[model samples]
Target: WFISYALDEYFYFGIFYGMILVFSFYNLIMFIAIRQKQYLYYVLYNLSVGFFEMSTDGIAYQYLWPNAPEWNQVAYAFALCATSIFALLFTRELLFVKAKAPRLNQLIIGVIVIRLIFFIYCYLFNQTLFSFKFIEAIPLSVAFFTGIYIYKNGYQPARFFVLGYSFLFAGFTLKFLIMLGISWLNFGVVSYYSLSFCFVLEMVFLSFAIGDKVRLLKLKKDKAQQKIIKQMAINAKLKDTVNQELETKVEERTREVYHKSLIIESKNQALEEANSLLQKQAEEISRMNVLLEQDNEELQTSVEKVSRDRVMNTEVDFEEFSKIYPDKESCYGFLAELKWSKGYHCRKCNNDHYFSGHILHSRRCSKCGYEESVTTYTIFHNTRIPINKAFYMIFLIYSSKGKISSHKLSELLSIRQSTCWTFGSRIKKVMDERKKTLKKTGKNGWS
Candidate 1:
C-alpha cells in the first residue's frame, strides 16, 4: 500500500509541476518578445505557485533543500508571499489601474506594503503563523475587485482579466474554507490540485487579455490612417475643380484675342482698298497714307504693351493672369517644355531614351528607371502651394518691384500670411541675383 501511494503521488505532482514550469517558460518567452513587464511578473507568479505546491507536497525538501531540514517549515510561507506580491504587480500593470483608477491603484500599493510587513513580522517572530496561508485571500480579493471595477468602466481588456481572476478567486475561496476546519469539502486528489488547475485557466485568459488590448489599439490606428487618406482624396478633388474653372477662363480669353485680331485684319484690308482708290489724288492719298500709318502703329504698340503687361505686370488683374497660366496642367506644361526643351537625357545614366513618368509633365529614364519631375530642379520643388498660384505670386512680387506686403499678397492669393511672406522673400532674393539681367531682359527676365 505504501509503494502504490508513493507512485500515485509522484505521478500527479510531476504532472502538475511540469505544467507550471511550462506556463512559466512560455510566459518568459512572451516577455522577451513583447518587452511588456506584466508577462515577466506573471512568470514570477506562476513560479511562486509552483514552488508553494512543491514545498507543501514535500517535493522541495526532498529535491531542492535536501541538506537543510529547517527550511521545510517556512518554505511555503515564502512562496505564498512572492505569489501574492507578483500577482498584485501583474494586476496593476495589465489592467492599467493607475491611469483608470488612481485611488484603487494606491489601495493596491498599500495592500502590498501591509502584506510585506506581515510576512517580515511572521519571519522574525513566529514562523508557525506562516501556515495561515488564507491571509492571501486579502491580496487575491484586491486583485479580483480591481479587475471588476476596471472592466465596469468600459476597459475591454479587463473583461478577460476579470474572467482569469474569477477562477483563482474560487480556488482561493475553497482553500480558505478548508483552513476554516471544513475537512469534508476536501475531496482527496481533486481538491489537492484544484488551485493548480485554476492557475492554468487564469494563465490562458490573461494571454487573451493582452491580445485583446493589442487588437483594439491596432483598430484605432487603422481608423486614424483611413481618415488621413480620405482627407487627401478630398483635397485632390478640390484642386482638380479649380483647374477646370481656370481652363474655362482660358478658353474665353482665347476667343476674345482671336476676335480682336480679326478686327485689326479687316481694318488693314480697308486701308489697302482706300490707298488703291485715291492713287490718282497723290497729295490727298499721301496725307491719308501718313494718318493711316500712324493709326496702325498706335494700335500695334497698344496691343503689344497690353499683352506683355498682363503676362508680367502688377496692374494685371488675377482674372487676366488666369488666361496665361489658367491651371496646374498649363503651368506644368510650361515647366516641362522649359526644363527639357533641348532633349531628354537621364540624369543618372546619361541615357537619352525615356518614358512619361507617374507625375504629370515628368519623365522617367528607360535605362536607369530614374524619374524626374519637371519642377525637381526649379524653385517650385517640394513646394506645397499650387503651381499656378506660385507662378502668379512670383509675377505679382516682380511687377510690384518686391514692394508688396505679405498681408496684401495673402489677401490676393487666399493663402496664409506666413506662407505668402516665406515664398515672397525667396522670390525677392532671386530677383536680387538677376537684378542686372532684369533691367536688360525686361518682363521676360522671370523666365
Candidate 2:
C-alpha cells in the first residue's frame, strides 16, 4: 500500500508539473498577443492556484495522509485559502464589473482579506474560525456562479471557465463520494487527471476563440478598404469624363475662333485693295498736274517773244508762229502718240491712224467713233483731291522719317488730325500691298 501511494504521488506530481508548464507557456503566449492587464492577472492567479494545488496535495496526501501531521494540515489549509482568494480576485477583474458593481467586488475582496486574517489567526493561536467543509463548499459555490455569469454575459473566455470549473466541481464531488465510501475508484488520482484534462481543453478553446476574433476583425478591415477603393475608382471615372468634356469645349471654341479669323482676313484684303487703287490714282494725278504746269510756262515764254518782235518793228515771224501753234490740229497729237505706242492697230480701218482722234484735244476716234480719255485708262481717273494736294500728302509721309504723329501731319498740312490719320493709314495699306505683291512674285520665281 505504501509503495502504491508513493508511486501515485510521483505520478500526480509529474502530471501536475506538466500541466503547470503547459499553462505557463499558454499564458505567456496569450500575454504576448493581447498584452492586456486582465489576462496577466489571470495568469498570475492560475500560477498561484497551480502552486497551491501541488503543495497541498504533496503535504496532505503524500507526506502526512493517514498519519495526520500537524504542520501539514496547517500548510494545506493556508494553501487552499490562498488559492481561493486569488481565484476570486482574478474572476472579479476579468468581469470588468468593478466599476458597475464596485460594492460587490469590494465585498468579495473584504471576505478574502477577512478569511486570510482568520486563517493566519488560527495558525498562530491554534483556533479555527470556520469548518473545512463550509470553507471549501462556499468557495466552490462562488466559483460555479461566477463561471455561469461570465458565460451568460457572452464573455469570450467564459466557455473555458465554465468547462474548467465544471470538471473541478465534478472531481471534488467524486472525491467526497469516495471519502464517504460511495465509490470503489481512487477518486484522488481521478480528480487530478480530470482537472488537468479540463485545463488543457479550456486552453485549446481559448486559443480558438481569440483566433476567431482576430480573423473577424481583419475581415472587417479588408471590407472597409475595398469600399474605399471602389469609391476612388468612381471618382477617377468622374474626373476623366469632366476632363474630356473640357477638351471638347476647348476644341469647339478653337474652331469658332479660326472661322472668325478667316472672315476678318477676307475683309482686310478687300479694304487693302481699295486703298491701293486710291493711292495709285493720287500718284497719277500729281504727275499730270506737273506736266500741265510745264506747258503753261512754255506758252508764256512764246507770248513774250512775240511782244519783243513787235516792239522792234519787225514783221510777225510766221515760222515762229507756226512753230508756236504747230497746227492746232496736232495739239492733241499726244493722244494718238500714246495709242500708237501701245501697238494697237484698228482692223476696221486697216491702219493705226484711223483709230486716232482728229479733233483738237478730243479723245474720240476719227474713223470708228471709238473714244477714250487720256486719263481714263490711267491711275488718275475719278480723283477727288487736286493733284498738288495729293503730291504734298505723299511728300509729307516720306519726309516724316518714322512713326509720324497724325497730329503733327495735320498741323503741317493745315488739315484735321482725323483726316490726316485716315490718309496716313491709307498710304500704309498701299505700301503693304506692294510688299505682298513683291513677296508673291518672289515666291513664284523661286518655284
Candidate 3:
C-alpha cells in the first residue's frame, strides 16, 4: 500500500495521526484532571476511531507492524469492533441515553455485545468470518439517529454530536463503496486522505460537543444560585419591615400609656385636695352655726331690755304699736301728743281754746276761728308711707347701732330703697336741727 501512494501522502497521513494522538492524549489528561466519565468516553472514542482509520488505510501495517504482515488481515476488523464499542459508550454518556433514551441505550448495548462476540469469533476461528461493512455502519448510524432524536428533544450538545457523526458516516460510506469496487466518488483524491480529513472534523466537532455540555451545565447552576440569593434577600427585607413596624407600634403604645398615667395622677391629686378643703369647710360651717345661735339669744335679750326701759315712754313693738295706734284715729291721737306737748292755742289771737272741726282728726280754734290738723308741725306731715310704716321706720332707726344702708332698710321695711333714703335723710336733718337748737337754748326751747 505504501508503494502505490506518494511520499507526500505519507506525510499527510502522519500529520493527521499526530492530530488524532494530540486530541486523544489531551482528552485523556482532561479525564484524569476532572474525573468526568464523559471525558474518559471521549478519549477512548477518539483513540479507537483513529486506530480503525489507520488500520483500514494500511498506515498501521507500514509503520506500526512492518515485521508482521499477517496481522493486517484482522487489524481493521478488530479496530472497527473497538471503535464501535467506544463510540456507542461515548454516545450513551453524552446524550444521557440510559435515563433519557432508554430504548436507544438498550439497542446500543446489544450492538456492542454482538460486535464483541463477532470479534472474538474472528480471533478464534482464524477465518474471514462475515462482511464487517454493515457491522461497521450500524453503530455510526445509531449514533447519528440518537443525536437527531436527542437534539429534537432540546439537548443543546447534540447538534455537535450530529455534525461530527455525519462526517464519520460519510467517510464510512465512501470507504465501503470503494471496497466494493465503486471508486467514482473518490474523484482523484485518495480515499484514505478523505477519511483522514473527515476524522479530523469529527474529533473537533465532538470536542465542541463536550465543551458545550459543560457550558450549559455551568449556566444552569449559576441561574439556580441567583434565584436562591434573590429569595433570601426578599425574605430579609420582609423581616426588617416587620421589625420596624413592631417598633413603631411599641413606641405609640408607650406614649399613650404615659399620657394616660399623667392624667390619672393629676385627677387623683385634685380629688385629694378637694376632700381636704371640704373637711375644713365643714368645721367652719359648724362654728358659724354655733355663733348664729348665740347671736339670736343676744338679740332677744336686747329686745326685752329695750322694752323694760320704755316703762315711762310709749313702747313701739308690734303689740304696743297695735294697742296705741290700732286705727287711723288712734294714729292721729298719738301724732297730736308728739306735735303739741303743751295746751292747744290759737296762732293769731293767742287764746287757749279749741273746738272739733267738721273734718275728722282736725281741731278748730274758737277765739280766732283758726283750724289745725293733728299731723301739723310733725315729721309725719306730707308722708307718702302709711302712718303705721312711719312709726315702724322711727322705731327701727332708734334701735339700730350702725347706720343702715337704704337697701337693708328697704328690705326690712318692705318699701322701695328710694323711699327709705328720703325718709331717713329727712329724719336725720330734723334731728340735727333739733340738736343745734337744744345746744343754743339749753334743751328748753325745743318744745
Candidate 4:
C-alpha cells in the first residue's frame, strides 16, 4: 500500500509541476511579446500557486530550503497571499473592472489588502493557522463575483472569464467541504488534486477571453477605416459630376457665342481679311506637310496664328491664352501698344512727345512733364487682380459681344466672380459708350 501511494504522489507532482511550468512559461512568453500587464500578473499567479502546492506537499523541504526547517511552516502563507493578490490583479486587467464596474474594482483591491494583512498576522503570531489554506475562499469568491458582475453588463469577454473562475470556485468549495469532515466525498488522489485540474481549465478559458477581446477591437478599427474610404469615394464622384455638368454648359455657351461672332465678322472688312488669311495659311501648312514634313517657318506661322487667335477669341480657356501673355510685363506691352495706337496725348497735358516713365510701359510728356501709365485711363486701372487675368477678361468680354455673364468670365479667367462682375461692368459701360464707333471701326474696333 505504501509503495503504490508513493508512486501515485510522485506521478501527481510530476503532472502538476509540468502543468504549472507549461502555463507559466507560455504566459511569460505572451507577456514578453505583447507587453500586456495581465499576462505578467497571470504568470505570477501561477508561480504562487505552484509554490503553495510545493510547500504543502513537502517538495520545498526536500528540494529547497532543506537546511531551514523552521521557516517552512509560514512560507505557504506568503505564497497564498501572493496568489490572492496577483489573481485579483489579473482579473482586473483581463475583465477591465475599473472601467466597467468601478465598485467591483474597489472591492477586489480591498480583498487583496485584507488577505495580505491576514497573511502577515498568521506569520507573526499563529504559524499553525497557515496550514488552513481553505481561508483563501474569500478572495477567490470576490474575484469570481467580479467576473460575473462585469459579464452581466454587456462585456463579452467576461463570459469566458466567469466560466473559468466557476470551475476554480467549485474546486475550492469542494475542498472546504472535505476539510469540514465529509469523509465519503474523498476519492483518494483525484479529490486531492482537484485544484490542479481546475487550473488547466481556467488557463484555457482565459486565453479564449483574451482572443475574443482582440477580435472585437480589430472589427471596430476596420469599420472606422471603411467609413473613411467610403466618404472619400463619394466626394470624388460628386466632384467629377460637377465638372462634367460645367463642361457641358460651357460647350453650349461657346456655340451660341460663335454664331454671334460670325454675324459681327460678316459686317467687318478686317475680320474677313484675318479669317481668310487664317484659312489660307492653315492650308499652306497642311500642303508643306505633304513633302518631308520637317520642322519649318510655315508650320511655325500656323501655330503662331492659332495662338494669336486664342488671344482674341472668347472660346479660349485661360491656360491657352496664358501662353501668349504669360506675365505682367507681356500684358503691359500689349496695353502700351493699344493705348498709344493713335498717339500718346497725356491726360494732364495733351503733349504728344514723350520719354519713358518710372513705371514699366508708362510714357512722360516732354513739354508739360505729365506722365501717364499704360493703365492710366484704361478699365484695368487700380484693379486688385493680376494684370494678365484682367487682360484676358477684356478679350473674353469683347469677343462675346458683351453678352457673356460675369460667372462665365470668372470661370474662364480664374478670377473671383465679384471682381469679374465689377471689371466686366466697366468694360460693358465703355462698349455701350462706343457702340456707334465700334460699328464703323471693323475688327480693330476694340483697340
TM-score for all predictions? 0.57, 0.42, 0.55, 0.55
Q: Poorest 10 consecutive residues of model 4 by lDDT?
A: 288-297
Using lDDT as the yardstick, the better of models 1 and 4 is 1
* Candidate 3 lDDT over residue span 1-447, tens digit each: 666667877677778878878988988888887778888877877787778778877778888998887778778777778778888999999889898889999998998888888889878884567455666788788888999999999998999999998997888788778777886776766564666788889999999999999899999878766765676687688667766765675567557556655754565566567876666655555565566556556755755554444332423455545444445655776777766677877777888888987555677898777888877677888889877777767666655522667787788668999999999888767766776888887763212
Q: What's the lDDT for residue 218 in model 1?
A: 88
lDDT of 1 at 193: 70
Task: Write down the lDDT that model 2 would get.
Answer: 0.57
- Per-candidate Cα lDDT values, in order, are 0.83, 0.57, 0.76, 0.80
Tens digit of per-residue lDDT, candidate 1, span 116-173: 9999999999888897777888999999999999999999999999999899888878
Best by lDDT: 1
Candidate 2, run of 10 with poorest lDDT? 320-329
TM-score (C-alpha) between model 4 and the true structure: 0.55
Cα displacement (Å) at residue 31, model 2: 1.7
Per-residue lDDT tens digits of candidate 2, residues 284-345?
54565566556556655655554443333233233332332233233234444664577555
Candidate 4, position 135, lDDT: 74
Candidate with maximal TM-score: 1
Worst 10 residues of 1 by lDDT: 305-314
> Judged by TM-score relative to the true structure, which candidate is superior, 2 or 4?
4
